[model samples]
Target: MSVATAHVDIVAPAVPGAAPGTVVGAAEVLDRSNRRLGRVPLRAEISTPVEIPHEEQCLVHGWSPYLSVQPIVVTGGRTQQALLSARPANGKGSGGEESRRAANGWIRLWGREPDGQWTVRDPSDMATGGATAVSTPMGSPAILQIGGGRRRPVCTLVPEGSLFTLQPTEHRPQGPVEVRPVADSGFTLLESLRLGEWGWATVVERVWWDEPGVRGTPLFDLAVAYLACRRGNLERAGQWRQVAGNRHEDGPAWIDVLAVDAWLARRRGEWRDLASALARLADAGGTPLVAEGLDLLTAELARPPLEPRAPHPGEALRSVLTPYLRASLPSSLTSFTAAHPGVPQPRPPKRARPSESLPFRVERDTSATRIQWRVLSGPPVDSGAYAPVADRTLLPREPGLIISELGELSEWLIVEDEDPMVLWRLSRTLLDEGVATGVSIVPGRNAVAVALPGLQVRPAAALLADLLGQGRVRRLGLSVGGLRQELSVPDAAEAERILAVLLREGHRSSP
Candidate 1:
């Protein structure tokens, strides 16, 4: 199904040039939309509804222009009809360019089957010839029914309950995102259709992302943690997991826990970290079963490793062991252990011998904070036991507080910071003092003097006062992600003053 025909028009077309993927309401059109519009590098505001063909809409790059995705947020934008979807670059809209129809395809709903396959849900209670047959009027922002079409006066299809809803994973660049919502303003767009306005749209009572907001759910954190694990940044994954540990109700979504368990096992003797993780899993949702398996397989860090032994009936194994069916557990640990290898024998931390060429080197990249390992020296002789071979670039899911590795490095490297203060504060906190510290300040967009000043650095916030007070640096602001696999901000002239104050306050002395 073409996106236009499939996804409901999600926005009421009043505000223009608003942020992509944001849901705004009519009441907030002036406040939120206006503030976002001000941030826009361009001035593309056109509040009056303008007609543009679907094919002319620009394709949004990031989680944008979800024009066809429904349960719309009332946002304002030049292409107010579309959200993440944008105007096709080739179009001047009113010019003499030939117009082509946007392609359409089979509309599918978001659902999964029991056997790990995806399937579609029938839009029951929906008239067979409802939305697909009619063109979507971008001007509206409600779930319009054929009978509920044309919000001239809202048809009564809503109070009856929706036939189906889109259930997407949250907080993903490719998935769903929602901004904060306001109190339910008694205001609503009450236009309803009599016969043919089903797709025209009316004001929904509790619109998409407006009532009790998305922040209340753990789905966003789960999705973020999942993505961090996928990227092989265990530090970030662990941090997010900690943030979400209290959300036991959403434990089923930790889809990568097994892989996490495997990697955690490889850490020299991270039995504590591994145990904490498993405990959370048990208490949160998949306890008893998952905990038992992990303890037996990944928990041991003994030398020479304990020989594989058969279980001697479970009833008295431990006080925590509850009676569970054998079928619930894995039949074989041999393959699993061979694939991931149980706990590695303990060794001194990597920083102990900085001069030695190591088997693996973990570092982060500027874009999208990814923690990856590039093989340095070949893998040690027992490399076969480790699931991740030394030759391959490995994105480890959990490296267990690997910051000390960076602290011990004695090399000259440039870690560029879009926000210099974050680079300053974090590196100072995480790295060993005087790890060849130097500060780079770009006080103004047009400022010529880029300085590598020799001063005791401090918390990023203080830099703003020093540099900006001297009328040298631009304004400053701040934010965080884990260092190993995350991202942060600051600027220069004002940056200097901020540094002085921070240093005097003893927050940090070097970066």
Candidate 2:
């Protein structure tokens, strides 16, 4: 019989009902068959919090629950101590007020530089937390800052549950070579369908945008600045803000970017810098909503602070700044918007032209409990022969809604485009609607990969062919049972020539 320690990542619960910050010794005991036994209490000699690397288990004995059952003790690497104690299913835990006040699932990352500073990224405060209201380090877990922009010249840490990793692997030859996932080098994308939309964005951007020569989009820089400032890295934040300012002169989105920079400066108490950023921001175009948001910030800035009577004095200032920092233009400042009112508005920008719908097939082996999706470049199969295993009605029909009934393993919704902007738009649309689970947008290439579970294959392929076929999606690939096909892309005519030859030779080509 074999026994193994019950393991968990940084966020797993230790004691089923143990209170947060309350010290408890726990060890799992097993019988000869290695089943049907409960935990046995141990001596509370080690006082470390019940977190990763400290907690203990007794599945085989002499193993820390935090470190799984690994025998070797690894130390002296950059150690980050995060508070990941388990909260009760009802959101309550031990230590009463202490447990309630303790930051659960929040991680404190440490870099090799060994600074004593701790930066916080709280979601409730937009002014400090940036767009996502969560603080992320300037580097590490290298996937966050995608698009081959300039590397952040500082150490950073990846989140515990992050789907992407910086660990190095075999390289690929492409537009921009994949960099090592070192603290100094940038991050690369590993194929993942499990990460949420945010994870996809980070990985896609890293692979597509964070290139050595590629300058990031203005919005991307603004986001970086927000994260940098929140982590008390004013130098890094200022650098990113400068990059953004250099990329834009005037526009509503630009105004919001400048406003965020000004807000960060204000938070850092750099009054002179704040004034300069606001001056630049005021020069940018503003709508009625923008004016109102700015007015709120100015009003709050002019108001006096509560005389320590308020439970949280910072809350008042945060309330005003949050809206201003979050405000952004719906669309980018365009030539049409900048054109004179008397003059005719310039023609709308052209979009991608629709291409041939990539042919695909879906098959399921119920006995094996597996499914397969194949993108075909051959003759199309008759629809009458195919039937969906899952009911189509169970899936969401709304433009932005996602359908997921299958378990946690993510299903994919793959798109092939040569334009990053198109991929970004589609990704943002799906993400905003909570449909996109994972995304892979390679920069300088017109290809995208995303994961969305709960979609029936037949309808999903049809739906994509309809919506994306209208000049949005060029090719599509949806995977099931780990089956996938790769396209050897060339010029259109060249690709057709190759395809014709392959078809003549009886090759089952990929999309």
Candidate 3:
């Protein structure tokens, strides 16, 4: 039988930026004999309604190769309308005698089959001449009316290399649904199970551990501990496993728990326990599992070296002074005695032999009552004549007196009622016996002599004595013309005399 042909409009809603009169394309189908079947041309311009009432428009630019359709309900306020237009290849018309067309084809719309095939039908039968009808098939190339009052079957048209697309009439009821492009069932199931397992592990670790009723669940605790071990939190993992042991038949599997225990023991330096646990794991077929423990064990085989203790306070001081004393000594004594006149002579306490140099001398002062003086000098003296003499004196009637080594003296005669006797006694004592232990006496213009037992003479004794009395020693003595000296003693008596001479002579020479 020869098939009859009729033109049908396939309408669809307009997409944004599409030109007017655009259509969706359809798939090309072949018969069982491998012969070319009919081509269903897209005939209508599909459009969506604009916000303004009653105006319909579509996008149709570059849509010539595709077919589009829209299903309609007869009872709606206005049936959704589609305008038909076609542009053939090379800008030819699709509708007149001179129009180029597909070979001897009839139009068919189909409801999608369960086996991914199509069941063809006609559009004319779907729209009756007057009233909408159901199940009316018109001739060999016919339109089947499936719904008006009855539910309509959804029909979809798809083009090659695209997904099948469907549009439903408003009057049609919901039916059986299926998803296309089915995914691999095994892969999907595995991924879902893995995600669920990790979620459960997280809940047990973070939430269940603190929950009142859930805290006693051993399986949950074990799972959490296992995850903790995997994450390298040995301390927390061990605690969780220990708690789980009380509630579960098996706690975190023996091998994993033992490995964590071994790691902890290794950190605490319990090498014996670590070795025992590692051996046990190896015997139980867990040698590879305890690899980290074995590595830690190997590292512990070499012991670290010890550090020396810090020096004591006395030791530290001696250490610091040793080099300083060796470099300084006798030369420094000249500056030292000049700086501190109150210091006593640097003397050996035993009586000196006639050939020996006297460190200091004691001389009686006849001019003053009960006044005995000590004197210091730059070089030790064997004869009493070389000792410093009390050249100047002041009586109680005098206000105060200053005796310089070079015979320069000052008296505060304006204050005579003051106890000048004390001043006189002090001056005589220092001049007779005081010995220079730190500084030297040198001759100079405007320079007074000062006694320095151990150092070279750099300044006159008078200026050195003034500097000593003023206590401007170390800092003031650095200048080139200044007599710089340091002091040292082989014994304590010499040191004591040096101190005494400094105090006595300092008071004697005070202005």
Q: Pick the candidate with the highest lDDT.
A: 2
> What would the TM-scores of all predictions be?
0.23, 0.23, 0.18
Writing each residue's lDDT as its tens digit, candidate 1 over 1-511 gives 5422112122232212223322322211111112211111111131213222332211211111222111111222323443222212223233213222111111112122333332323332222111111111111111221110110111010111112111112212221111111111111111111111122212222232233343322222333333344345667656654555345332333323433543444343455554454454443322121222333322322223222352222213222222122112221110111100111111211222212111222222211111122233454232221112111111221122123333322211223333333333433332234422432211211111112233243333344344445443344332111111111223444444433433343222233
Ranking 1 against 3 by TM-score, winner = 1
The better-scoring model by lDDT among 1 and 2 is: 2
True-structure lDDT of candidate 1: 0.25
- Which parts of model 3 have CA positions greater than 4 angstroms off? 1-204, 212-219, 230-235, 246-252, 286-511
Clashes of each: 53, 19, 66
lDDT of 3: 0.27
Tens digits of per-residue lDDT for model 2 on 29-93? 32223342343222122222222222222121112221121111111112222112211112222
Local error of candidate 1 at 254, Å?
3.8
